[model samples]
Target: MKALLSLALLLTWLGRCTGAAQVFMEPQLRARAGDSVLLQCLFLDPDSKGWTLHKVDWLHRAGAGTQEEMVFFYYSNHGVPAGRFKHRVQWRGNISRWDGSILLQDLRLNDSGTYECELRLLETSSVFMRCEGSAAQVWGASLLLPSSVTACVPSAPKPPGLCQQRGQPGPGAC
Candidate 1:
């Protein structure tokens, strides 16, 4: 009987740990060249400890391989843009509530493709301490092609914005 009761408690604990605390992106958004977009993120946690958002970014898969590059960084209070991504992206969410939504203005042909909105959170405790969650991954932030762009048309050369050397965080890497 004791063993069965213990198993029940363990299952309950596991359920909470893997519960809805996960972060997710709304959907793949598309914008015309020189247009703007609103990146949305939802934090599905019910606990009142609140959330502290950190290290929000937008990544684009460069070339024909699987790896991607970081075009924007949203930490340290400044949305530092890579030399190329400058004047192209901005954060649209409220900094205080962990709304990590971002805004990207002026979509270029080089911007057409799959883009992902990456984000992190710091959950506070009753002891006045904080705990950070793993980086969440969402797929399919596709750039919609304007009627002007042909299927055979290759986008312009992307400004070199790689994430590898930038000390950027990865999904579950934090």
Candidate 2:
């Protein structure tokens, strides 16, 4: 029985670890012009505790645009771009099993186009590296945020007491 168990384990490892590590997308889906879709990415490796997902990036190409820049990027709440997806994206992979998938909320029509998730990992020797895979044609409308919300966002928060200082002085005068 011990020999049989060992054989089973070996076959399982071979099946999941046989080929080059790659990212896979799910749902076999489609979305309309104003719909939001969640794209999931997985890295497969039977051996080891799964590939380390150091980072995930999204890219887009709208109409004739020549491969536009990164839509959003994240690593420990940092490296996020000031774009349409600035605060609408979140990643929950750091908590368990190191899943690199990201969840995007309130997706817009402009969010359409080809998207890619970039994965970075350490090889067997602990060497750092990165790999990227693309999302299928995401058909949606041109990217645009509501004028009211856009106007409310400031470049940065006002320093503490700055607002109070505007209408008063020395903190003692009326």
Candidate 3:
């Protein structure tokens, strides 16, 4: 018997650059093998005008203390998904709206790790100051919103209390 326990993630705005863009993310997720999950990330840009994006990168770590690798990257109009995520991930957010979210499909046991979303602007020479809640700096060009999921595969006979229990605001297919 196995159990899949899903927990919520924390979102903290850690910057002080008067008008620089900041990121906000939903909680982490939990699901079973063959399920799909959405990693949400939204950026709030002080400037009402649409901001130009240089690149959007999605990184993943196999587990705690493991090295992070590229899951997907978007530049210009082309997106490249790497490694095991080559055909299982999708970019479902619009950068013009400051959204950098993604949809991860075909969940696998080894995919149990931390996923991070980073957004870099095309304009780097300009010094922007964003002071919402506290920060947003030149050093803050990259936003890190990492979400993780814990999953499991049921053994034969499917013992009681071994099923995954997830609710509200998550993938309904689980």
Candidate 4:
């Protein structure tokens, strides 16, 4: 009986450690030239204890044939913006809250494309944990600037009732 009890406890612990989290962002975003846009990357961690954030990287791709450019990098409480993104990218995220969002100011026509956010999490012991989540993308524009634009739509189909469970009305419900 003691052995069975021990096995049960071990299973419970494993379940807690393996709980999955969802990392998402505004699947699509639109901003005009010279405007500013916020690319929100949020992680809904299933573990109540929360995980330690190790780093976050943001990349951008201009078009189909273009290579992805490293736009931003954050680690050890420091942020670095690369290339043309220097001085234009702002770290608006908080590690404590699992928010890896960012703000891109002074948008240019060449910035019209897709942006991706990559995140890494670590265990309390500072050991690398398995990365298990999806990324979000943002689409930029240079024409027909809207005075005030704030919208988010999932880029792909999510599990039914997941958004509702989060008190969100799901895509197109906005």
Candidate 5:
């Protein structure tokens, strides 16, 4: 009986050391340009048996057939978004709560792409278990006008040399 008890105890301990947490995220989202999108990412800790949050990486892939870019990261501290996401992405979830969600603000048409939330957990055996989930975003018909663009609203008067005739070769049609 003592041998059987020891075997059972060993099995339980081994299971705890090899367990990995699972990540969850929305599958798809449809939004309009110039809007904010909250990419929800939550994880399961399984009663905190032996897993601890190590790192969280937020990745984005522009359109299709493109490489994913790590837009943000959290390592029990904070992450500063860089490059095109410098002033756009915001990490709104807490690692302690097993939430890795991020809020994508001031979204433009170019922001329509696939986003991934990756989580790394340290197991009881000092090994790392990686979990990742992704979601695809579709943006509505719209444009992000830059400072150099003189595009006018339908109600506004067309600017000089800005609006060209439909058949003429110039900028955009009024």
Candidate 6:
């Protein structure tokens, strides 16, 4: 009886240690100015138990000493983008699919930096039968854009003589 109880305790300790070391996936993304990029954050529920995503927040940092700014926040099925990024960021993730990705549109030169995704999970009796605590998983990645790639802007229309038709090459007739 004593040996059986000791073995059970050892197994429980090992399980907890492993669970505490869970890792969040981060993939480096590269994009040009004016292109959209998706920063992904996905994790595996070790015990096969589900969790209720309470909040999702994305932060951005340009360099040292600079405060990490909140780029986007999503909760209660609504997404809010920060100040200047209000018209550039979008929530492209699905809670049911365990995806916490965000789409950054119209990328600018200053957008080249590190982006972090933080996911807060809520405990519920229905899905998470035995949650230890409110789990906040974070994943981050760096985005790089060449300096030569400038933000795309609308250019003035070309002369009618230089215009070309659909499938046609050069500045010739259709």
Quick one: best lDDT, which candidate?
4
TM-scores for all predictions: 0.50, 0.49, 0.60, 0.59, 0.57, 0.55
Worst 10 residues of 5 by lDDT: 2-11
Estimate the overall C-alpha local distance difference test score of candidate 5: 0.48
lDDT of each: 0.40, 0.39, 0.52, 0.53, 0.48, 0.47
For model 2, the stretches where C-alpha displacement exceeds 4 angstroms are: 1-20, 32-35, 46-51, 63-65, 76-82, 123-174
lDDT of 3 by residue, 1-174 (tens): 122424244443332333334444333345545767766566554344455755667777665578988888777877787988999998877766655667778765566555566566676633222111111111112433233542111123332322232222333332
- The digit string of per-residue lDDT tens for model 5 on 1-174 reads 000000000000212233333333222234445666666556544444555776777776664577877677777587667568878988787778767777777766565444555566654233232333233323233422221000000112333343332233554544
TM-score of 1: 0.50
Please give, for residues 12-35, the per-residue lDDT of candidate 4 as tens digits. Answer: 011223433454334334454577
- Which runs of model 5 end up more than 4 angstroms from their true locations? 1-21, 123-174
Best by TM-score: 3
After superposing candidate 6, which stretches have Cα over 4 Å from the reference?
Answer: 1-27, 46-50, 123-174
For model 1, residues 1-174, the per-residue Cα lDDT tens digits are: 000000000000112234334443321223444566554543334244344555556565533455666666677677766646677767666556555555666655555434445554445222111111211222234522221110101112311231222233532232
Off by over 4 Å in 3: 1-7, 12-21, 46-51, 125-174
lDDT of 6 by residue, 46-132 (tens): 334444566667777654456777788887788899977889988887766556667888766566444555656675223221111
Candidate 4 backbone collisions, by pair:
none
Model 4 TM-score (2 dp) = 0.59
For model 2 the local lDDT of residue 30 reads 42
Question: What's the distance in Å from true for residue 28, model 5?
Answer: 4.4
